[model samples]
Structure formats: structure tokens, C-alpha cells
Target: MVGIVIVSHSSKIAEGVKEVALQMAKNHPVYTAGGTADGGIGTDPVRIQEAIEAANTGDGVVVLADLGSAVMSVGLAKEMIDPALAKSVKLANAPLVEGAIAATVEASMGSPLAKVLQTAHDARNMDKVE
Candidate 1:
């Protein structure tokens, strides 16, 4: 089972998404990195790196970001991860809500990080089209 990392500007957002994802797939691992519930930004490179490290402990890791800053933060953290694990890290393009669902579903299916990211992206696109 691939693990998941939800990164957002707000920790509440990340936590909310993680909760929903967990509800969808009880056994999957869903870690979060982002701003705190008090609205404090949670874009620390070290924290992001830790979250990625935790997610990577499983088969692979899928990272979903809420915005550009989250993306840059995760990208920076990716550089700090082990080469083998970093190679498996991927960015999910699905929106906060849909991406969480897609990622959870894909992770539960034992999908590779790339495929999970693609599924999330596709789901986001589909949502946009609908």
C-alpha cells in the first residue's frame, strides 16, 4: 500500500483531507504537512521532509498540495529525501477534495506513486469538465 502526504496552506485543510481519505480507506497511511490550525503557515522544509520520509516508509508516497507554496515546499523537501524514495515521490494535480479521494483510492489499490498522481490529476480534470 502506497502512503499519502497532504500538503496545504492550512493544517486544518490538510487534516480535513487526511480524515476524509482515511474514512475512504481505513488501512492506508495518510500523513499531512501544512499550516497549523491557528492559520500559521506550515511550509517548513524540515517538516515537509519528515512527512515525505514517513510516507515513503510504505510501498511509495503520493503528495498532494493545496497551492503553489505547498508545491514548492514539497519540491524542496523532495530534494532532501533518499534518492530511491525521492524518485518515487509524485505531485498530485487533483484539487484538495478530489485529489484526496483519488489518492486514497489509488493508494489502496497499491498503485505506484506516478500512477496515483496521474489518477488524482485525471480525477481533477474530470471534475473540472463535469
Candidate 2:
């Protein structure tokens, strides 16, 4: 099963997104990396790296981040982790909440990494109003 990581400047936001993703797929692994070590509103590369490692389960890990800095942190975190694990981690270019939910659903179905990533990216085209 693929894993998931949610990154946000606020710990609450990251945890909230994880909560929502879990509701859709309780059996899947979803970790969060949000805020600074001191509980401030900032992204931390080390925290993101730890979350990535924790979320991974030999399959792969998908990361959804809110804001640019969070995304950058994800990149830095990837560099800090093992090369093999870094290769298995993907960063989705989709809205954090929607992407996490869609990816979780796809991964819960035993979908491969590429499919899960595609599902997350596809969420960008969702027509919420229609």
C-alpha cells in the first residue's frame, strides 16, 4: 500500500488534512510534517524527512504540501533521506486537501505509485461546482 504525507505551515492544517484523508481510507498510512520544531508556523525539512520515512512502507509515499515553502521543504527533506527512499517519494502538484483525499482513496485500492500520483494530479481538474 502506498503511504501519504501532508505538509503545511501550520501543524493544525497538516493534521486536519491527514484526518480527512484517513476518514476516506482508515487502513492507509498517512503522516504529517507541519510547522516548526518550536510549534511556530513554518516549514521544517527535518520534520518532513521524518514524516516521509515514517509514512513509507516499502511501497512508496506521496506528499501534498500547502504553500511554496512547504513544497521546498519537501524537496530538501527528500535530499536528507536515503537515496532509495527519496526516489520513492513523490510530490503532488495538486491542492493539498483534495489531492490527499484522492490519493488516499486510490492508494487504498492498491493502486501503484504512478496511478496514485496521477490521481492526485488529476484532482487539480476537479469541477467542484459542477
Candidate 3:
């Protein structure tokens, strides 16, 4: 199964999203990369990289970042990885909470990395008003 990583400037938000996503991905690896090393309201590349490494289970990791810095942090984390491992990590351009849920459900179904990434991306088209 493909793993999942949620990155957010706020630690609580990241952890909370992970918790919710875990409901669908009970058997999959779900990780959170949040806050700075000093407990500030910011993203940490180190933490993001660690989360990516921990979540990876050979299939690959789908990263859902909350905001600007969190997104950049994930990118920086990817840059820090070895070329081979970097290829296994994808920075998903999907909404954090919704994307995490969608990805987790897909991953739980034993879907491949590309399928999981597609499901998360599709969440962006969902219409809440319907």
C-alpha cells in the first residue's frame, strides 16, 4: 500500500488530519510533518523529510501540504532525499484534509502509487455545495 504524509504549519492541524485520514487507512502508514523545530507556527524541511522517510514502505509516499511554507518545506525535503528515494515521494497538489481522506481510502484498498495520487488529485474537483 502507498503511504501518506500530511504537512502543515500547525502541528495540531497536521496531526488531526492524520488522525482523520487514518480512519480509512488503518493498515497503511500515515505520517504528519508539522511545526518548526522550536515549536513555532512554521514548516520544517527536516520534519517533512523525516515524515516522508518514515511513511515510505517501498510503494511510495503521497504528501499533502496545507499552505505555502508547508508546500515549500515538502519540496525542500524532496530535494534533500537521494535521487532514487526522491522519485518515490510525490508532492500532491491537493487540499490537505480532503486529499488526505481520498488518498488514504485509495491506499487502504491496496491501490498502486499512481492510482492513489490520482484519487487525491481528483478530490480537488469535488463540489461541497452539491
Top candidate (TM-score) = 2
lDDT of 2 at 102: 100
Q: Give model 2's TM-score versus the native structure.
A: 0.97
Q: In order, what lDDT does every prediction score?
A: 0.80, 0.94, 0.89
Return model 2's CA RMSD, one decimal.
0.7
30-105, model 1: which lDDT tens digit per residue? 8888784356975766677888888776577888888888788888888988888888788777788788788888
Clashes of each: 2, 0, 0
Worst 10 residues of 3 by lDDT: 20-29
User: TM-scores of the models, in the given order?
Assistant: 0.87, 0.97, 0.96
- Arranged by TM-score with the best first, the candidates are 2, 3, 1
Off by over 4 Å in 3: none
- CA lDDT of 54 in candidate 3? 89
Q: Which candidate is the best by lDDT?
A: 2
The per-residue C-alpha lDDT of model 1 at residue 96 equals 80
Residue runs of model 1 more than 4 Å from their true location after superposition = 36-39, 128-130
